[model samples]
Target chain A: MNTTTKAEKTEKFAEHLDQANIQGRGVSPLTKLDPNLTVREAYQVQLLTIQKQLEAGQKIVGKKIGLTSVAMQNLLGVDQPDYGHLLNGMVIENGEEISFHKVLQPKVEAEIAFVLKKDLAGPRVTEMDVLQATDYVLPALEIVDSRIADWNIKLQDTIADNASSGLYVLGGKPLSIDKLDLAQVGMVLYKNGEIMNTGVGAAALGHPATCVAWLANKLFEYGITLKAGEVILSGALSAAISGEPGDHFQARFAHLGEVNVRFSNKVDQ
Target chain B: MSTVNYQSTAEFLHRAETEKKDVFRITADYPDMTIDDAYKIQEKLVAIKLGQGHRVIGPKMGLTSQAKMKQMNVEEPIYGYIFDYMVVPEGGALSMQELIHPKVEAEIAFVLGKDIEGPGMTGAQVLAATEYVVPALEIIDSRYENFKFTLPDVIADNASSSRVVIGNRVTDPAGLELDLVGVTLSINGEIKDFGAGAAVVGHPANSIAMLANMLARKGEKLKAGDVILSGAVTGAVMLSVGDTVSAKLDGLGEVSFKVIE
Candidate 1:
C-alpha cells in the first residue's frame, strides 16, 4: 500500500540512519515515513544500512535475533521475531564503561552468548544442529539503543533499524553446552547493587539454542550462512532496563558466572 | 623501618611468577599489611627482577577506569612496573605455558618525550610531555588463583602486570583527541570488544597525570622514553592457545599477537 517504490524507501531510511549516527541524533521511526511498508521492504532497508557500514570498512561479526519473547512481540505488536546484523563495531567487553553520547535512548538486557565452532546454514537448521555447532555458552549483556527518536518504534521501524541492536558484552567464563540444562538457567540483573529484573533461559524462546536455530534458518532464505567462530547473542531473557550515566549494571547467570557493564559520563565528540 | 618482611615476600612473588605457579593471596598471610607496606613489597619485587638483568621499560596504570574501580570497589588508580621481559613485540607470540590464567585488555600506550615529576601534574602537562601514543594490548596474569585478590595482594604482585604488545602506528599527542579515540579488539579476525580512550579515567592522558602524581608521592618520577600503559579500555578477555588477538585503535594502528602453547 506504500506509494513510494521500495528502492526509494530503502535509500531514504539508509540516509536517515547514516545521518543519525553521524550527528548523534535520532530520527523519526521508519514506519512514520511509510506506514504501508511491508516487512520484506523493511528488511531491505536494514540491508541498505548494513551495506553502507560494510562499505565503510566495518565487518560483519554475527547476527542477533530480537522480539523472541511473547511479551516483546506483544509490545511491538508483531506475531514473530526479527533478525539483525551484528557488526564488529558493536561489541563491548564486560566491565567496560560505555560513553553516553554514542547512543540514543539506550537500554540494557541480560542474554546468553553462543560461540559457534562449526558453520550452520539452511532452511532446515534445527536445535540439534545449533547444539552440535555451539562451542561454548556464556553470560552476556546486550545494550540496545534505538536510532528511532525516543524509542518510538513499530515492528517495521525496528526491523528496518536492525532490530534496535546497539552493542553487546560477553564475559564471565564460557562453558561447553553439554554441561548443564540451559532452559532452566535463572538470570538476575542488578543495577547499582539493587535487583532490577529477573528471568530464566526459557524466556528466550523456550531455549536459547532454538533462537539461534531460528536465526540460522531465517537467514538461509537470503542465502546467508552463520559462519564458524562467530558469536551470536540470544534474545533478551527479560524486559530491557533503562540505561543511565554512572549506572553499574550486572547480570548473574546460574551455573554460568556473571557479566557487568558501566555507563560513563563522558560524551564523545 | 617496617616490621613487614618485604624481601622474602618479594622473592616469593618473583619465584612464583617465573615458575608460572599460582600462589595464595598475600593478604591471607599478612592480614594487617598496610598499603605502604604493599608498595614496598612491590618495589622490592621490581628490584629483584631488575637485578636479574631485566630492564625497567616503563610503568603501567591499573584500575583507572571508573567501571573497574566500581567493580573492584576501590577509589583511585594504582601503578606497577613493567620490565623488558614483559614486552611482546608487535605480531609476536605469547606462550601460554609461561603464564597462569592470562587475560588480554586493550589500552593506549603513551611514550613520554620529557621527564615528568609531579606533586601536582595536570592532564595538560602530561599531554605536553607525551611524544606519541599507540595502541597497546596488555596481558595480565594474576599469580593468585581465580584472580581474586585484595589491594595489597594485587599491588605486591606487580598489579598483575605480565606482557604488553605495542602497535606499529604512532601519532603525536598534539591536536589529537585522545579522549575520544576508539578501540576494537578482535580474536581470530572477529571483533570481540570495543571501547574508547575516554574509559581511562575520562581521558587517557589523565591516567598519565595520575601516574605522575602517584609516583611523586614516593619521591619517584616518570623518566623520558617511558612507555606508560594508560589502563584498560575494556575488561580482560581470557586467552587460549592458538588464538590470535588483535587490537585496532582509530587513527592509530593495530597491535596483534598469537598465543602458543
Candidate 2:
C-alpha cells in the first residue's frame, strides 16, 4: 500500500468497490479508497473531478449548497451544510416547461435568487458584503429530481448525485437588491389562483444573506470561489412541492415581484 | 359551536383552498402506527394521485424540533408533501379510515414571490427574493401499509407529507424572531405539541435554503412563487377522531383543524 501511486490506489479501490459492491469503509466509513482524505477531502476529490470535467468540455456555471436547513443537518447528523457543482447547461430559464418523463423522481420548491454584481471571494465575505456585491434579486423555483432508483440514497450517494438537483425556473420581476426589504419580504405559492403555502424571508436563517455567507465561507475551505455572474438559489422558502404536467405554479413576492412556472407532460428543452 | 362535515376528500380540500373555512378533521382506523412504512406507500400513492390530476403543492417538515427528533429515535426531523386536493379546512373533520397513517404537526410555510434556481446561494439571497410569510398546519399521512422505514426510507418518502393549510400572509419579517417564535399545539383543547420556529433547523428559512442549493447541483433550481414548507417547528402528536388541534405562534397567526369520523 505504501509503494502504490495515488492513481494506482484510486484505480484499485474503484475496482474493489465494483467487485464487492461496497463503498467507503476502507480506512473509515466516511470515504472509500483514499485513507488520507477526510470525508470533506474525499468530497474535494469529486469536486476536482467535476472541475476537470468542466475543464475538458462542460461549462461551469455555479455551485449548489445543501444541509443548510437545520432539519437536514440534524437528519444527516451534521451541523453545517454540503454542496456540489453545477453546469451552465443544467439550468432551465423562466417560462420553460419540464417533462415528467425525463426525471426519475421529481419534486418542486420555491426560493430567492441573487445575481452577483462582483466576485464573492472567500475567507473574508460578510452579509453586508453580500448586500454590497449583489446586483439584483428575483423569485425563483427549483425542480429536484434524483437519478437514483427509488430515490434510495445516502449523504455521499446524494452528493455524488449532485444533491439531487434537476431543473430550475426563474419568474417574477428582477429588482435591485438595494430596493428590496429582503428580510421582511412575503411570499405566496399558488397553483391556479389557489394559495398552497406562504412564508417569509426571515425563515431562511433569519435572512437569505446568511445562507449566502455560509456558502462563501464553506467554499473558502474547499478552495472554491464564488465568481460574479453566478446565480445562487438560497434554499427553499419552505419544503418543496410535487407537480405534474399542465399545472401552473407561481410565487408572488411582496415587493420584488412574482414568478410563474408551468409543467408539461413531456420534457421540453 | 357548529360542526360541518364534507362528503369527499376532494370537496374538503376545495373548501380549504378557498379559505371559506378554517377547520378540518379526519379519522383514521390506526391509532398507533409509527408512520414510516405508511409513508413509503404514500409516495407511490401520491405519484399516482398527481398523475390523476391532484397536484402536489409542496412538503411539510415534521418532527423538526430537537425535542421531537429525540422522541422519534433520530437526530433529525421528518418530511411530507401537500397536494392541491388534500387541503382540509380548519375546524372541519376528515375521515380517519381514508388514510394509511396520519399525524398532525405545526409548521411555518413560506410562499415564494420569485422564481429561484441556483448552484450556490445563501440566506440573504433568499430574503431578497421573498415577498411575505405565513403560518401553516401540515398533516402528515403515511401511505405505507404500515409505518415502518429506515432513516433513508423516510427521506425518500418525502417525510410522509400528506396535506398543508396556510393562513393569511404576514407582511412583516423584522418584527418576528423566526427561530425562537414560540408555538403551542393543542388537541381538543389539551396541549399536544409545543415548540418554536427556531426548532426548524435553527430557522425555517435556513431549511428552505438547504433544499434550494441541493436542487441546484442536480441541475434543478427552486422557482419563485413556489410554496416551501420549511419544516415542522414542533413535534407531531397523535390525533383521534373528534379531536381538535390548534397551534398559536407568538406573532405569526394561529392555525387549527379537527379530526372526525
The global C-alpha lDDT for each of the candidates, from Candidate 1 onward, is: 0.85, 0.62
Query: Candidate 1 has which clashing residue pairs, if any?
Result: none
lDDT of 1 by residue, B1-261 (tens): 336799999999988899999999988878999889999999999989888899988999998767677877888988898888899989999999999999999999999999999878988999999999988999999999899998888999999999999888889988666654556677998655555566678678989998999999989999999998999876689999999999766567689999999
DockQ of each: 0.01, 0.03
Candidate 2 lDDT, tens digit per residue, B204-248? 777677667655544656676666788776567767888777776
Backbone clash pairs in model 2 (N, Cα, C under 3 Å; residues 3+ apart or in different chains), count: 113
Please report the candidate that would top lDDT against the real structure: 1
Per-residue lDDT of candidate 2, residues A16-76 (tens digit): 3222123212122223323354455346445654655576688867666655555565576
Docking class of 2: incorrect
Per-candidate TM vs. native? 0.56, 0.48
Question: Model 1 over residues A1-269: C-alpha lDDT tens digits?
Answer: 36566577689887887677877888887777778888888899899889988998999998888998878888888777899989999989889989888677789998888989999998889999999999999999999988888989898888889989999999889799775666546566778986555555666776788899999998988889999988899888777999888888998776678899999976564
Top of the candidates by TM-score: 1
- After best superposition, candidate 2 residue A75: deviation in angstroms? 2.5
